[model samples]
Target: MGETFYIKNMVCNRCIASVLDIFGKEDYTVESVELGKVSATAGKKTNKSALASKLKEIGFELIDNETETLVEQIKVKLISKIKSGETEHLFQSLAEEFGKTETALSKLFSKSEGMTLEKYTINLKIEKVKEYIQLGQLNFSEIAYSLNYKNSSHLARQFKTSTGMSMTEYKNLKSWNRKTLDKIV
Candidate 1:
């Protein structure tokens, strides 16, 4: 049997590849590597803490508890959905997707991550909006529609609240300031 380790900040394909490379360099036999979890057969002398330290050096962290692991899994799924260019859904749908009750998941997420899932999703959407704006391919209304916001003004209000700048101000700035998916929280 192999041990499964949950990792924070492994939210993309590049992250998956990077983690596999780290396991390879350390001579660990990785049975599977997914967005935020890795299953590996442990060697006789494997050092979990040392491997964890190595992961931290590259902006990842090992999750030890079920609550923390679940929190990271929720984050990974939410981030993936936001980046997939798909339609948005209610929190109930998210709960159904994870096979958990919405109330339980909401409490766990708020307790473990210090933010409600709704706030986290909003932050993720705001980050995506910044990316769209940076590309300069869409106006505010278009960006709003693409992101499933009710209207351009609604998106602008959320963006301003999150970034302390209006969409126009963000566009007129000398440089773009954007955060990556893993760094959003």
Candidate 2:
């Protein structure tokens, strides 16, 4: 049997690809790496700590235990909330399901990542909104409503606050930057 290590900020498939690439370079056959755990055998010629160091250098850190798992779960849920409106039940509103209060989650998240849960959630939402805008499938008003925003103007205001650019301007940019963010495990 191999070992499993949880990871933070691993919210997308690209993140998984990047992690596997690193392990492959070191001759480690990664068995599996989901949002919650990385299953891998101790390679004959690889140092797990050294591999960790390399991951850290590239902004990937190995995680362990329940607290870490819960945190990542929260982040993934928040990301999905923004992306596909998948949270029919808990849309940036994990308070009722998690047993603990959002205040407590926010405290733990802030201590771990130096940013509040709300801030992280909002940033992710903005990123997804940018994605929607770039794809040009949904209009600004529709996008705002889909994202659970009160109104198009409110969404525009919040977006401007975070990104310093209006939706109109961001969508109009000839050279736009599409973010290939982390995956949902």
User: Which numbered prediction scores highest in TM-score against the true structure?
Assistant: 1
What is the C-alpha lDDT profile of model 1 across 1-185, one tens digit per residue?
78898999998899999999887776689998889999998777678888898899999999998888888988888887778756467577779988999888999899887889889889999989888888999999999998888889999999999999999999999599988888877
Find the number of clashing residue pairs for candidate 1. Answer: 0
Could you say which candidate leads in lDDT? 1
Task: Name the 10 consecutive residues with the lowest summed lDDT in model 1.
Answer: 85-94
Q: How accurate locally, in lDDT, is each candidate? A: 0.87, 0.75
Which residue pairs overlap in candidate 1's backbone?
A: none
lDDT, candidate 2, 15-113, per-residue tens: 788888888877687888765457887778988788888888877787666777778777766775566675444533686657777678878788877
Clashing residue pairs for model 2: 11-182, 11-183, 11-184, 12-182, 12-183
The C-alpha local distance difference test score for the whole of candidate 1 amounts to 0.87
Name the regions of candidate 1 deviating beyond 4 angstroms.
none
| TM-score of each model, in listed order | 0.91, 0.77
